[model samples]
Target: MKTIKPILFFLLFFFTISCVNQKQKDQEEIKQTVKNYFNAVKANDLEKCKLLIEDSENYLGVIQGEFNFLHKNYDEINPNDVLLRNILVKDTLITFTNEKEKYVQYIIKNDKNPNNLKKPLIITFMFYKPVGYDKIFNRVILENHIGWDK
Candidate 1:
């Protein structure tokens, strides 16, 4: 029994380490996905941007500017049409103590008009893990409002 106890202890430790490593890797992938998503917008590469996002017919989320559903087809989304003025990411604790983290995005908008190159508009995105049994990270828009400068 003594030998068995040591073997079980080592196995448990190894399993715990593996789980932590996997979680770290998952978070890194999520971060990269987010980076690619925004870089595609900044460089006006809408085609590249589509790969990182989930696809749905009614998958509508405002990208600032008075426009929603920028393009019926994800491939047709225009980077120039959707100006990514700025991006801010915030980390929040959700569950499992420090094991889980949430990211939020705050973006400013610029229009497609050639002549009107003035100040860009601002928008905020609050991302969080949804309730229920599923274990997934998702963006739940906590708030969306125009800039106060109006």
Candidate 2:
């Protein structure tokens, strides 16, 4: 009984460590994916951006619209210029699909607008990893001109 208890405790400890390590690795991958996506945007590489996005067809139109809008209004919008303000990771449920997912929300403080507008640009990019999925998918991009200070 004494030997069995130690074996069980060791197994439980090992399992806990394994789970924590996996979660950390997942978070790093998600962060890298976001950085790569932004790098593609900075280089204006739409093809690369598409490759990173899951269900690209469903979201392509929105991506293209935003791309066009930025190009038309801003001289050169470099996503790299947006300073990293905060990154939040949360587990959320998809109401429509009823799927459990993990979300990584990147809140960027956009201070690199070449147009030199007065209002602060707070751009948020949300990426999700559905349960059982290894890849993180781009879900949404939100631009707030009013800023998040208030």
Candidate 3:
């Protein structure tokens, strides 16, 4: 009985450590994905961006329109600038599966005007790993809001 107890305890401890490590790894991957996406944007590499995204068709039109607007209005636009700013992440639940998901939000200024500040732009991304999948299957560009607070 004593031997069995120790074995059970060891097994539990191993599983606990594995779960923690997996969570950390997942978070790091999500952050890396975000970084890569922004890097592609900075370089105007639409192909790279499309590769990183899951449902490209859904958001491609919006992304292209935004790019056109930025290029027309701003002399120099860098996605890296916004990436260097505040980034927030929160835990989200998938309603149908009751599975945990990640919601990442990036908040950045629209213009270069330091004196007069307007509402910041908020870009949110949702990441989900489907059941039986080892890695995140979907990285959804959930929303892109201009002149929005946090």
Candidate 4:
């Protein structure tokens, strides 16, 4: 019985560490996605940005709207570079879908407009894991220009 208990404890510990490592890997991937997005916006490459996020029809208008103004008068990048340091990320523990999952939100500052004022944009990512599947798929949300508090 003593040996069995030790074996069970070791198995539990191994599983816990595996789960933690998986979560960390997932968070890093999400952060990279956010970074890629900012880089795309700075380069004014809409196609690359589209590829970086979820490819969905519902996002077409939102993505275009954000960039449409770029040619008009506003810009998406700051006067200086907006690296990962310039952005703040928060991960929510609440699930929007299933599997006790969560979402990630990134708060960032926009570039100087033609009028030379900077603004804020909210970029969020939601991921869902399929039932009985080990993989997760991500969907991105970007909100801007509505008087963001931060």
On TM-score, the candidate that comes out on top is: 3
Query: What residue runs in model 4 are displaced by over 4 Å at the alpha carbon?
Result: 68-83, 86-89, 93-101, 106-121, 130-140, 144-150
Candidate order by lDDT, highest to lowest? Answer: 3, 2, 4, 1
lDDT winner: 3
Cα-based lDDT at residue 48, candidate 1: 58
lDDT of 1 by residue, 5-106 (tens): 999999999999999996666555445555555555555565454343333112334232222222232233234434233333456664665644555454
Per-residue lDDT tens digits for candidate 3, residues 40-148, read 6666777776666666667778666554443343223344355534445578887898888786775546555565456555457677765212222454342334432
Worst 10 residues of 1 by lDDT: 132-141
Q: Give per-residue CA lDDT, model 4, range 1-150, as digits (tens).
A: 999999999999999999999877766765666566666666778787666555545577766666554323223334344445554334445455434554556556643344436456665656544321122134336467554322
* Ten-residue stretch with the least lDDT total in model 4: 130-139
What's the lDDT of the predicted structure labeled candidate 1? 0.43
Q: For model 1, which pairs clash?
A: none
* Residue ranges of candidate 2 with Cα displaced over 4 Å: 68-86, 95-98, 106-124, 131-139, 143-150
Clashing pairs in 4: 77-111
- Report each candidate's C-alpha RMSD, comma-separated, in the order given: 8.6, 5.4, 4.8, 5.6
TM-score of 1: 0.48
Clashing pairs in 3: none
Ranking of models by TM-score: 3, 2, 4, 1
* Candidate-wise lDDT, in order: 0.43, 0.58, 0.59, 0.55
